[model samples]
Target: MCTYLKNMEGYKLKDLKLKEFDSIQEMFDRAFKRQKVKDDKETTELKQLMKIILDEEEVEIDVIPLAVKSPSIIGWKIRKEGRKSYYQIIRADGKSQTYMIFSHMLKSFDREDLENLYELVKAKYESTRPVEDLDLILWGDLKTMFEPHIEDKVWKNQQDYKVLNWKLYDSCGVHSLRMQHVQIYMLVEKKYPLTPSTLTMMLEKKLMIDYESEMAYQLLKFIMK
Candidate 1:
């Protein structure tokens, strides 16, 4: 039994035991059946909607599901003649958005561009935001700001990155600063994949800052409401 459990590649022993499944194969078969039912339901609903929206007899639609704490169906990716269109359900009024942000991100940026963007954000944060501000944002525990492995790198090779004094600021600005830093850190070191589509989305959203007055001023604007 121990060797069998060890040999199971993807299935966890705890999960199998908790689910009262006799074997890993059985667990997978049951999960597959459940997912198949869900996929069928989603496909049927999405196909009908796509046909109506496109006003065509035939349309190929791919349902894109957002993976969240409580996962829910979100949108459809329609493809025809080597072109793609995204439609996302966002509000209660039965109105849907033509542009899907997630799909746009996936289609826009590449890894190198993302890395460059991370560096730019980090440089901006370091230059514009004061060390004391970081302390204020993080409640004086600067070391805990980033993950354990990258703490030293983030702290500029210091053993303890502490601020001698802290000053309180407007709650909104402080919140933005904290969010800016957290987002850059996560994008550079965590889950964000360095892909072409991601960069394109950033540019499309006007989130990228530039030295020029016009472009820099435009950074705050987004196409979406």
Candidate 2:
């Protein structure tokens, strides 16, 4: 097992004082109880979809509603006595439905595994792109632009510099750098509506990377521009 997972083995939801609802509706009700506007049709439909997916997958999950500005539901699944945790989110806008299972646990990954994962994420991102946007700048574009300026060969020596950046930044925070990357891309393209929480979900489950040591700070700097 991964060291991170091992460290989390003793943790439990109840230990955090998190109350799990028996059904998704109950969870939503609790989440929106204080709000003047209740859960809308889009949010309801998305919750139903999440329930179906969980049932079909036979996943044992604890449905927890988030108390954020946007209406969303999160399903948490624990396996092997908290040795593994999976988080799945469904948003009202329907653009951010995805599962973040084990990919967040990157401490156990070797260089080759990280490379393969990076390639997989790149291919998936490319496949989802619009035909007209195929040539647009990507994580690789940023990496290529910055590689020659980097003095340390350790960053360049990796099979894919993008993966190296992801490793370093993910180690810093769960999805900090990737979220900033998405924010920058959205700023540059003037598209893709994003919020801090939704962008984090996309990074963990959908949106997928750059650099060596300074990438996260560089991403922050880019956003400041």
Q: What TM-score do all the candidates reach, one by one?
A: 0.18, 0.20
lDDT of each: 0.32, 0.32
Q: Candidate 2 at residue 223, lDDT?
A: 31
RMSD of each: 21.7, 22.3
Residue 151 alpha-carbon offset, candidate 1, angstroms: 42
lDDT measured at residue 176 in model 2 versus the true structure, 0 to 100? 24
Q: Model 1 over residues 108-202: C-alpha lDDT tens digits? A: 22443223333433444544553443223322222232223433343333322222211111111110111213322222222222234333433
Q: How do the residues 1-225 of candidate 2 rate in per-residue lDDT, one tens digit apiece?
A: 233322333444464356444543354444454232333553343332121111122322443433434343222122233544343334444422223333332322233333443354355555565222212333343233222233333323332212211123233222322322231212121222233444344333421232222333433333323
